[model samples]
Target: MQPSSSPSKFDNMPGDIERRPSVEEALDHEPLEKGWWYKPHVLKLNFLMLAPFVTMAAWGFDISMTNSLQSLEAFNERFDHPSGARLGFYGASTQLGGAFTIFVAPFIIQKLGRRAMCLIGSSIIIGMSIMQTFALNFNMFVAAKLLLGFGSTGVQIAAPVLITELAHPRQRERITAMYNTTIYVGLIAGAWIAFGTQDIPGDRSWQIPTILQVVLPAYQVLTIFLCPESPRWLVAKGQEEKARKILVKYHGGGQETPLVRAEMEAIMAGIEADATRIRFNKTDISALLSHKGNLHRILIATVVAVGSQCTGSGLISAYLPQILDNVGMTSTREKTLINGIINIWTWIIGLGAGYVIPKLSKRSLFLFSTSGMILTFVVWTALSAVYTQQGGYSYGIGVVAMMFIYNAFYGMCWLPLVVAYPLELATTKQRGILFSWMFFCLSMSTFAVNYINPIGLENIGWRYYIITIVFTLLILCLIYFFFVETKGLSLEEVATVFDGRENYDAAVSAVHAVEVKQAGEPEEQHVERKDER
Candidate 1:
């Protein structure tokens, strides 16, 4: 509501298009909205937002468990001591499976909706995980995990997009950024279980740890039924009444408050405005390439996706046992313990970064992370060179410290924003397409480095850090020039960063303007408007 002494700051502007306080800002100033976040409906909204943690944790658990398994003597003996190319295939199998089905995820999300995609993905993971846990042969085990990757890609595509499109406007940024932190939770759990089970007899040591991986995905399948579909997705499918009801129940405390109306109005306006520009259920690949603003988004998505895996993580994350061996450490138990500790460290860093992300721009976050990595790699490379030539124990210790420092920077930016950045930058229809491309690209990059990391580490030793240092510099340059500021803006407001202000839909703030007109007068609270689509 406007104060009596002053006109809106936009009063002198030339166009009839209006600008108003964001609904989030207005809600903060409203006396009626005190303790708003603690309300029961908003709590329920947060629970729905938290439901995807199981899906994220599942990925973390798999990566950590697989990493620990490589160091286990029983598992190696059970599988006939897989080494060289066979071991590389063991790590690359899931990624290879992702390459097969990643592009199809967007099509399913576009047709059946994001909720449907989550359900289907969880169900597939559940089946494949059971197969993985009970497989009688190594070939059967690899086949089961390969199919599991096929399913994980679907949830990976939908979960972040759900948080992006459905969270309450004020909670969206932090929640979406924190969304990936759940993966670290999974990683920590996996590490603890594998370390604890190290002394168990025979195959149970590994099998028991693998069985726990299935539990999180099964939990997601059950909880997803209790949550509402994305209001934006609902609106795109001509289900405006359903979208409004869901928003009123959750975002408005079961009433059409000004905040709720403002958000709904913005969603309707954005969709209606983009209707001519996008076909809601159709594939957006061609549409995205044809549009200048969207194409720029795709380029950033590629940089983020490819840069995330390519930036020296491959050697540390999956091959830490080998790295430790090169540094003259040789206890299997010690290696397992170190694996657990590193993940705990990563989880702590992930939470800290997620909490702070809302206060800074996305561009600021990525630039800081990439720059830190560049410096870490340069020092790390020099340390490795010294340890290899001079054979000093102190040089080896310094190299290990540098690995932890490098991942701290990686977790600060890449772990959280890998998906969050692209989803926020996308238009409604572009969400699914952007996620598919990002994950597909991520899979391909991970696959490349999975093979390259072991061979490079064995052949050239520490010189592999040189390649990482150079590639990461290019990533930092792209982020500084391309990533835009989107600290507190709603999804519609974000379009202005890519598309110029005049080119964005002016209808976004029109309903808020109408509310400003009736601010002081006693009138109905509901700002009723049709869905226009």
Candidate 2:
């Protein structure tokens, strides 16, 4: 099939088309059973298959390392560095590896099923763990981290797609949140482990954290091996019967055959329908940019992805130990404890937001969350500087207040919302490429920030957050000015919105009209994710 170039599609689909499912019609349907959460077999399978995602504990392996020695002077002496430059280099390199992963992921996803991809990711992490545990020098350690970054990319790309495919429509956001939550769980786990082990005076003390990294991925591998393949992947591979069996087993009511069949049929229909209208070679970045609407969606996705990392999460996380020491939380153990707790609790908040997200209009959530981040940056920037400069107890309180609110708001709003928006906004035909470009932009932005944060600290001190604050404000303004609310809208309906000739209300009306004929069921059907579909 010839790839649909950008200009043709963009010319065909203009903005200003308003399209939404009828609230009443949507309300009339009963919620999909939340039984998957309670189903022991399915839950077991989910946990196992998702192990690679949960194994993100490695990201925090360096948290306590920063806190190992007493003061920055002491840390510098032990590491034989006048500054934390070595550590900063390590972090930036790791994130740079993530950027490489984004460039390679589309082909990887196409060639390998989600399960295989996840397993391979876990294996890469495991190998990197060994490399880290046995590292003889700085270069080896950095290389190990780079490998971990690559492995982590596999998990990052596959986990959301897998969870979205397996989860009931109502629970989609929650499941995705669970994926993020597991990442924090790993972080918290790593922190606690680091604290528990950092006191050892031997050269191998750091090895404890590196060695511990192996456990999560190891566990993930053992557990995931027993889980069923993604039904969507199964269908894609022409294993319809096996896909139905697995779907029925996990989806409850023991009578999911019909639902599975319906889902499969819908998926096939959707594929056929989409194929007839749009064609693209997955590898061609230019093909992705060919459609005006597709081009616009890619831009939006890229902006959102880049904006996510610019929020200063990486800055705070990388510098947590340093920041904590500045605030009189001098005990490495205490700092580790606090770090662990923050990661865990923030994850809980993210998970909570996910639970309620499906009910909110995507527009409302996006606006609210984007605004919340801007507010957080404002407060955090002010308080972080005050705490850093003034030696007042009130300033300390301000720092804590800002950190707490920042974590809460970030977890609840941006974490899952950013991811969900891109996936929902893109047409299936372009989903992989759009997401690839999104992650690519994210990795690039993240690497840039990681590299620059240290420079910011050395040159500007705590005032560096001001840069992020400006970006945060722009994020909200951009959402308000350029983005459209895409809540519960079908892809076709969303496509109709970008045809700029129509007025906003008129476009929406057109979307409403197109949706009845073109939109069949929500994309949550049991076998809906199958390859054919």
Per-residue C-alpha lDDT of model 2 across residues 1-533, encoded as one tens digit per residue? 22332222112333333333232233234344664466575566556555544544444443333333222232334446534565566657666777777656666665566667677777887998888777776677778878787787766676566655565443555565455555566566666766666656665556776677777677766665565665655654456678767766665335553444344443332332232122234655455455566666766787788777887777666667656655666665666677767777787887788777766676666677767766877876676677777676677667656776778877776776666677766544445556667777877887787778776776776677788888878777777766777655433335445533133233333333343335564433312112210
Candidate 2, residue 195: CA error in Å?
1.9
Candidate 1 residue 486 C-alpha distance from true site, Å: 1.1
RMSD, each candidate, Å? 6.4, 7.3
In the predicted model 1, the residue pairs found to clash are none
Poorly placed runs, candidate 1 (over 4 Å): 1-21, 30-36, 276-287, 509-533
The CA lDDT at 291 in model 1 is 66
Residue 207 in model 1: shift from native, Å?
0.3
Candidate 1 lDDT over 468-533, as tens digits, reads: 889889889998888888787778767667765542445454434444564553334433333311
Clashes of 2: 20
Q: Number of the top candidate by TM-score? A: 1
